[model samples]
Target: MLQGAGVVSLSGISTGAYATGIEPFRQVVTRYAIRPNPAAPWPAGLRLRIAVLTDIHACDPWMSLERIAGIVAATNALQADLVVLVGDFMVGQRYVTRIIPAAEWAPVLGGLAAPLGVHAVLGNHDWWEDPDALRRGGGPTASGTELTRNGIRVLSNEAVPLATRAGPVWLAGLEDQLALLPVRRRTGRGRLGLHDLAATLKAVPDGAPMILLAHEPDIFAQVPARVALTLSGHTHGGQVRLFGWSPVVPSRYPGRYAYGHVRERSDLVISGGLGLSIAPIRLGVPPEIVVVELGAEAVA
Candidate 1:
């Protein structure tokens, strides 16, 4: 399942146990360029750099504040114009309260510099926890009063127009497709749906190159065709994948869409993510911050 210079594969592991340990997970960081070609055409003169970090179950000590901070600092030094976080900000009940604590983690993450700023979306894990609480710390505030306080933008079923030197890039962040419930029954919620995605993307300016941040890559099946690229990272790239294969992958999507960059008619990039999930151990796929550059094709 290898495509071009990239590797594509499916996973068999579904549990959250194999995602522990700093040594194993630290290697998951990968870098790539997503420049536009004939098939994928962005604005000719506009070249934008995008950095992506996802599925960081920040509760794990391996992916400790120092490790996570280092990763963010490195990305900032790259001077990418935009930094995007996919999701799974927390690891359910385990690290619910400590997830991305602003007083600590934000100083490092918030220190990130990008002309367009940082943007993020919610994953099932975050939704399963206290979405209202997590939102209050980092990105968009639950009260919508601290949007600027944390220095990050959280997209949930909404589109924010980013003013770039080239003009404007319409960005949309979808609410976690997973179901939601009150505090007592948060994890008891049901599955998710893409019924709102189409309507959401349609709201964006037609013909404007659009990039979406959806925690789960499986949502691609229901997304509007106008979307150029969708960024995600819930699979941890098969956290404990052995020899490039995982015993199981916890994903709602069928087929090989559970991990990595799956190329359908459109483009999708899935980060292996920096932090751990259940057990906080990683094997093959390590944590990563992806770098993508967007532009037109080279002169032939």
Candidate 2:
């Protein structure tokens, strides 16, 4: 009887783990309304709804093409003014998960719609596959042609002017710094400096509110106060958190910038992301579609 009881107890434990840890990948939308500091020079009374989707390792086992479609559908339903994809479209190396070609998933990504249009930056995985391929399109890079064909602009160390009701805001995108490293040497926590962040900022006209799209949140340190906000994803909220604490955060400053809104030199929002990496299970921290409402009081 004791042995039978132990089996039942073990089964319960497994069930609980699946419920708390792995089940959060169902894709929950987390909404936030951020009011730019009144003191800042942002255009007054201008409200911009920005939807952010990131870290979509659209491969098999965990993330499938259908899942990607569902995520896009949900984002579209949000009726955002601007939509930004922060990268990591493909799964990283050293994982045993099923591999899906980028072409198969590109059209689905192309389908994402927003009034201001869709913009993206390449993630480490996309860079790891082939940097050249990622830029010009083709190869296994998930974002290239598929995104461009669908009208999603891929920003690589460049800035574009977006006219908002408040005023003209500049959107700048940075290249994946981790792509500069040798694939075998990437530990996921290493510092990335390949992209010229300063140069990207310089392209933006002075006094215009700027929004930066970077894949990793660690770059928050370098952002100046002039840039109103920075959006990023890479840590995945440590992928697993226990009692609100993440045991492993793929970042240099795990304690401070692992997830959520962090204020350094400027305001930063680190999304937990919509897909998984390294493993198929997520605990405590759920997959998220971050809906950020700008020019309003901050709320979660």
Count of residue pairs whose backbone atoms collide, per candidate: 16, 2
RMSD of 1: 8.0
Residue 10 error, candidate 2, Å: 2.0
lDDT of 2: 0.81
| Cα TM-score of candidate 1 | 0.77
- lDDT (10s digit) by residue, model 1, range 1-300: 256324322232332334332344454346655554345435667877888887666554455677777887788888888988777655543633455543455455667779898887767666555566443323243322232356777776778888988778888888766534343254444433322586668668877878888887777877655676788888877767667677778676634765665666677877777777766467767667787666633223
Instruction: List TM-score per model, in order.
Output: 0.77, 0.87
Worst 10 residues of 2 by lDDT: 133-142
Winning candidate number (lDDT): 2
Q: Which ranges of candidate 2 are over 4 A from the true structure?
A: 1-24, 38-40, 93-97, 131-142, 183-193
lDDT of 2 by residue, 122-142 (tens): 888776666575343334355
RMSD of each: 8.0, 3.8
